[model samples]
Target: PAAAADEPGTPQGPRAPLHGAAGRPAAPPAGAQPAAVTRTEIIDRAKTWVAAKVPYSMTAYWSDGYRQDCSGFVSMAWKLPANEWTGSLATVADRITKEELAPGDILLFHNASDPQEGSHVVIFGGWTDGTHTAYTAYEQTPPHTRRLDTPYAYWNNSAKYLPYRYKGVTAGKASTAGAGETVPEAAGPASHGVAGYPGRAMFGPGADNPYVTRLGRQLVRKGFGTHYTKGPGPRWGEADRRGVQAFQRAQGWRGGAADGHPGPETWRRLFS
Candidate 1:
């Protein structure tokens, strides 16, 4: 049954462990391959609940078999093999920097001491602007699942909301080309007609040139355009950095190599 009120405040006293409709514990199914999800897939799944207005319930389970609460909402979005609570959600996700946040990532606040005092989670839709002061948040609370323009992190406990990305999530398939858009095919280093590795000076902060435009176009072609709300224009912006980083990470690069700056190798791979 749905809670009498929508707020996910902690219930008083000790509580029984929550489970799925099948009476299984809130953990991934044994011996199952983790779902290789995409950002689009995660956001699409989240929107279904928002559209359906799935009600909030700690004990009740939705038809999809996930608990109808904050953590369950994220589990459903990530398409985990089973339901997960705030305490266990991190097991399947990696902590990410705020700057690395992109659509389909989550801002999680797990209150380990109380489990519910003010713990919550919200899916990061995207930054509302270049300022990075706020974002579009998709969440399930009280009344139901909702999409909101929330402040950086959240309205309350803003400092506690940390970013995370699902481990199984991929860069996703190439985006369908819009009219007049050219979709670049994945190519090897020897592929003919690939562009030369533009000098690194053409990218990074405060650098703007035709190469920036070229890079943005190629990023769009390669399906990393989710960061760009309007133009992947010649201007070097956070969108460009994020797109580059996402592409770099897609290639299994990390640390300094995936720092979001396009070096010679990154440029070659992107063009390839």
Candidate 2:
């Protein structure tokens, strides 16, 4: 029953990074672009980063830039298509559905009821071997660099990176049509394309088995969420599940229930 979800003193898990091993936020690889980064590539980079450190918020470490919050992180990670990219969590980037997620998918963690409420962002590294990790903007994460690892080891509150990671996909191959295929056209001076086309992250398209940590972070934030709240182990569980379900119901999800997996139908509603 939903009431059971509200149980206090529920066990949680560790904070997960949505990006990569927080090792040393390396400079973007030479000529790193979408064409070179397949969806699989995105996940690979994230895994490397996570095993190192954890992704942090630009606001927390560095402030005043194009992206400042969770969604902003997504913009930076996937690197938007252009400075004119039209989307935020409330706009373009916010259209993710659970099941549609893959590695490098950005998950926007925000207050469920407050439309203007700010949120955190985590890149999905979908499930792998019954465990998952993420790149996160955790407060303790290093300043101004993509951190890696940050394991979730749970199955709740995970968010997905939308449209961004899916930039140039053709069946399974990374699309190399336009140079602006993978990342945004406004990352740095002389924005370049990957290989032949502009590509995105190396994390795989529809990448599974490695992006669940972001989902776990989502659960931790809003699950038993409250002002200045903390949980056990950072793994989102009963409390987090309840919060996620409530958001889904408000979004008009059918038969809103927390069953762990964010399926396509679940995403359809969230995207709507």
Candidate 3:
């Protein structure tokens, strides 16, 4: 998911130099200290960068020496040790609902279990109105630090926009106040079943196995499991295959092309 360019950055007017003499990340904007930044300070610095129109690139890191992808941007703002991926980042955050979204929270798109279809993460700036139908957000997408509006065509297509709060940051303040928030690093490769895709691919109706069972569950989640009348257990029956085919068709592949097999794209979309 973090490997490809799903959303390209567009030209956001004039650009400012964001690197030091050796091309390292430049200093923080006015009023914010990188050593002990606050949640509000994080948002403020992000907003300032947006206003400065820093360019975006999936392969590049930010001026602060962090990867430039969605998750990388979050890690940079949150001040993590290295660039983090979307799947791993989700582990450190508590899932929240749209009603619970607040500044400093993350808005993510795509399946966290197995982010094959690709994923995007943005920082919630604030609500555009009281209705919560729309809101302002900041993200590193094509162009730079984009001020995104909710219900955006590409991001609002499915039940993928998840809200998350870093475990260290709290309701009204950072965990350590003057010392800034001390985010807990994710432990290990997150277990897939409950939080990610089971480490293996579920491409066919093989023998009864955990991968098949996981496939069935994903199919059911995608609303393509009409054939799963009994239940989606560990069995790899016709139901699972049919469900996969249906999902493939929905994704624009058809007939022989939509064979009930999981290819790279099919797997990505199914997990996504």
Query: For each candidate, what TM-score against the reference?
Result: 0.59, 0.33, 0.48
Q: How would you encode candidate 3's per-residue C-alpha lDDT over 112-166 as one tens digit per residue?
A: 4546454677787655444556556678776566665655213533366778876
> Model 1 residue 137 lDDT?
85
**How many steric overlaps are in each model, in order?**
1, 80, 9
lDDT (Cα, tens digit) per residue for candidate 1, span 89-185: 7878899999888778899988889876888888988765668897778898877889877788777778998999888888643221111122333
Ranking of all predicted structures according to TM-score, beginning with the best and ending with the worst: 1, 3, 2
Worst 10 residues of 2 by lDDT: 7-16
Return the top candidate by lDDT: 1
**lDDT of candidate 2 at residue 115, scale 0 to 100:** 28
In candidate 3, which residue pairs clash? 8-142, 9-142, 9-143, 10-142, 10-143, 25-63, 113-196, 113-197, 192-196
Lowest lDDT 10-mer window, candidate 3? Answer: 175-184
Error of 1 at 132 (Å): 0.5
At residue 247, give the lDDT of candidate 3: 85
- By lDDT, rank the candidates, best first: 1, 3, 2
